[model samples]
Target chain A: MKSLIIGIVAGILCTFSFIPQVAKIIRTKHTKDLSLITFSALSLGVFLWLIYGLMIKEFPVIAANAVTLILSLTIVMMKIKHG
Target chain B: MKSLIIGIVAGILCTFSFIPQVAKIIRTKHTKDLSLITFSALSLGVFLWLIYGLMIKEFPVIAANAVTLILSLTIVMMKIKHG
Candidate 1:
């Protein structure tokens, strides 16, 4: 039970981490130091994770990765736009 | 098997996604546009993920989150240093 709670907290943190990054990008309109490759790879990876979660029918995994995928894609787009 | 492969690939990509970001930070020495909150949250998040993986005795989760924790910490440090 403790571990499950820890995992959920961790998943929430990781999934929402990009929210500030998106805000920063929008506020500063700069991505010179941000890596396009990183966001791109993240988007792809999280997308796959989402798919895997669906295949396994895991609700937590699917929910977390779905949010993460959207966040990562947002960063990717911002990186490209600001670069 | 297919889902496992996809999961593995996703894990690998997400684990190594920070390599390019680290390289970019090192080369550019700029993180003004990068969000410290993002990296800090990511580091903490991945650390908890690692702990949860350990508790669950899952090798793949442990390995992936371990690497991700390290990478996210690196970014956090770089962001602080460069900012």
Candidate 2:
């Protein structure tokens, strides 16, 4: 139970960590300092994580990576648009 | 196994994703556009993941998050120093 809760919180933190970056970019339209390669790599990585989760049949990993992928992609798009 | 390989690749991608960002910041030293909150929260998240990995006795998880934590913290520090 403790492990599950901790893991869930950890997943949530890592997944939503991209949210603020997205909001900042949208609000300021300033992405000059954000690295396109970083976000692109992250998105690909998260996508693989989602695949791994699916293979392992773990809902938390799948769900977390799904949300993370979207946010990371959004950042990538914003970086491209604003770069 | 295929699963292990995929997971390892995913972990590598995610873990090293921050490298380019760090390199960019060091080169440019411009973080006005970077989101401090994003990196800070990400560092926290990665730290928790390390703890979770330790608790669960998962070497891959622990190792990945350990490196990620350092990289993410470096980012947070750069954000603070530059911003």
Candidate 3:
């Protein structure tokens, strides 16, 4: 129960980190100041974490990173399209 | 040695997940299609992870999430400013 709570809390906090930017982007449809290198690096990193999670059989890590990867990827795509 | 390697890999992977979005924002100065709810959830998740790491005395988790928090926050700030 404790671990589950911890996992849930961790997931929420980490996921929410990108809210402000996402909101701004949605509102203004702009992403010129964003860095492609950073996002690219970040995407790769998340991919690796996904693998790691799978290896360790950590469902929370895998699930969280998977969703995050998709969401982050979408934002990157939008930045490219609208930039 | 193995744990260190795992930590390093996980750190890099998780931290790098935001690279592409950051890069896009930097190059275009836009972020309109992004979702605030998602990012907010992600950030919160990471923050909680940081706390969890600290509670568990996991240096790798602490270091990785701290840096990630800062970088993610920066992107969010930029998105707001330029959007």
Which is the leading candidate under lDDT?
1
Off by over 4 Å in 1: none
Q: Provide per-model DockQ scores.
A: 0.94, 0.84, 0.43
lDDT of each: 0.91, 0.90, 0.69
Two-way lDDT contest, 1 vs 2, winner: 1
Relative to the real complex, the DockQ score for model 1 comes to 0.94
TM-score of each: 0.97, 0.96, 0.68
lDDT of candidate 3 over A1-83, digit per residue (tens):
56557858787566545556566677788766555565566667777777778777888778878876776676678778877
A12-49 per-residue lDDT for model 2 (tens digits): 88888888889998999999988899999999999999
Which 10 residues in a row give candidate 2 chain B its minimum summed lDDT? Answer: B1-10
lDDT of 3: 0.69
Chain B TM-score in each of the candidates = 0.96, 0.93, 0.78
User: Predictions ranked by TM-score, top down?
Assistant: 1, 2, 3
TM-score of chain B of 1: 0.96
**Could you give the DockQ of candidate 3?**
0.43
Worst ten-residue run, lDDT, model 1 chain A?
A74-83
TM for candidate 2 is 0.96
Candidate achieving the largest TM-score: 1
Q: What share of the true interface contacts does each candidate keep?
A: 0.95, 0.83, 0.59
> Among all windows of ten consecutive residues in candidate 3 chain B, which has the lowest summed lDDT?
B31-40
